[model samples]
Target: MIIKPRTRGFICTTAHPQGCAAQVRQQIDYVRKQPAIQGPRNALVIGASAGYGLAARIAAAFGASANTIGVYRPGERSGGRTASAGWYNSAAFETAAQEAGLKSFSLTGDAFTDETKARAVELIRKELGQVDLVIYSVATARRTNPRTGETSTSVLKPIGQSYTNKTVNFHDGEVSMVTLEPASEEEIQGTVDVMGGDDWQMWIDALREGGVLAPNATTISYSYIGPELTQAIYRQGSIGRAKDHLEATAKQLHEQLASGGGRAYVTVGKALVTQSSSAIPVVPLYISALYKVMKEKGIHEGCIEQMYRLFADRLYSPNANEVPVDEEGRIRIDDWEMREDVQREVAEIWGRIETSNIYELTDLEGYRREFFQLFGFETDDIDYEADVDPSVEVPNVSA
Candidate 1:
């Protein structure tokens, strides 16, 4: 099978196994080159098959020699159609872990369910005894409450007032202004329910109850705080409300972990092209501009670099340098990215941006390439025309 990207919007229906393997290998190579850092010996990564979650899993297994259990939603390959990038990513990670003599298992199911949590806990007890680090990185637009059997969807619109901003179709490099209506009260609440910290706290409570979290365990969840240009649509929007809930939940989780010397922290990361971010309006343009500046400044990093830094420098630094936390006790890497200087420069460039000069001011090309690379489409080493098996099985996939 020659797998390629089949996209509707912000999602690629087909994925390439070989290409995903290449991506995993590339991340491992990057980790190998970095200065050695000590990390958790046993770990569990929720949303562990794609984007930042996948990078965290790679870091744990390769950078720290940790035994890891990954939870993700797997896609089925049908009729010569390839699976989702996550499915292929899991396969690649499992293969790499085995080759490196590390224990790794991937569970395919909903991470929000009690049954799933029980299965994960059972696996941890039977295999690794307890997890020293838990990375909560699930990013989904919808989730069904297993307890009530009620399905809910999340909205990413702004609150209080409708927002209109310049956006780019990174796919085609088309720049345009987009106007998004404000989210309703119900929409805001639903978004909070889906993306907020409730599920994260639930996971922690379940793990604690099942004795799956080791003493002095540390848990981290990913967050984002972009520039003022995006504040209305992001940090101060519907999704922002959800992030607020998540940040607050981290404090509560910290209290819950106090008895065992464990702690929970939310690490706000820089904007990058991911499956989730592409769907948000105005973000593509902002990411494009940010990428240009960061690249020029030699500070551009992908998911792997960001996660590696988070673990090596912030989470597991030997010197115990206090991870820079905001007043809310959440780590704020994105704050550096959202500094007044950076935002002002970006805003200036944004105002001058037109279709003729957009490329000069933004990394639109880079964004498109990364987006395609997520589904294994625009990679260099893979022979896309070569015959391959779409039904390749992921090792240690719990049925």
Candidate 2:
């Protein structure tokens, strides 16, 4: 099959295997050229197929020389569709990890379930022995309670009143106004149940109980706190309420792990083009504007760059006795993204941005390129003209 990008709204329906592999390799190459990290020796990354989760896995294996196990729900091929970009990405990552003589493995299915958690613990015990670090990076629209079997589907909406904001169609650089209604309490609860830290806590409790966590171990889950422009739709929205639960869970788990001389933290990450972020109503426009400002200022950092720094700078800094955190005990890699000057400039553009000046005022082109790159498309190095296989497999994940 000669696979090309097929799109419907915010998702890409097809994935190019070689293009996805190349994307993984580019990030690996970038990590390889940098100084090695003083981080974890054994790691497990939940939702480790794409976006921030994938970057964290790459950083753990390549940057910190850690043996890693990844948990993810891979993309499926239905009729004419190709396997997801994450499937290709995992296959490529495993291929590289093995070629480089690093131990790597992956498991597929919902990371929100007990069966998945139990099986992951078993893999850790059987293969890697114990993990000193765990990165919980799963972001899903729905979750089923392992005990109750109840399903909760999350919604991205404001918590109170309606949220009206300027947005963009990065595909064609058309700016528009969107008004998202406030979520009901039920909707907010559902969002929290799906995206919150309950599952993260469950994973930690399972790992600790199964005795697969190394002594003095640490765990971190990814979170986001964008600028005030996005506060209504993001930080102060239903998802923000979920983040509140997630951050609170981090503190709760921190105490649980403390008995074993271990710890946990929530890392507030920067917003970029990701599957989850793209679905949010007003964030893409904000990210596009942010990209223009940050890139021009020469301080733009993607998932891989941010994860590498988290490990190298704060998480494993020799200058600190333990991982340093903010006043609320959360790690902040969103610093550059939340800088006052950056926000001020983005706001200036946000005020005057329209259809005509979108390209001039924002990085919508860059945003589109990165968005396509998420699905293994729009990469110059991959020949879209060539025949390709869509029935690709991740070589390391039999389970």
The per-model lDDT (C-alpha) reads: 0.87, 0.91
Residue range 89-158, candidate 1, lDDT tens digits: 8898898899889999999888989989999999999988999999999998998887688778898898
* TM-scores for every candidate against the unseen true structure: 0.97, 0.98
Question: Which candidate should be chosen as best, given TM-score against the real structure?
Answer: 2
Expressed as tens digits, the lDDT of each residue in 19-104 for candidate 2 is: 89999999999899889888899999999999999999999899989999999995756688899899999999999999989989
Relative to the true structure, candidate 1 reaches a TM of 0.97
Clashing residue pairs in candidate 1 are 1-388
Model 2: pairs clashing at backbone N, Cα or C within 3 Å: none
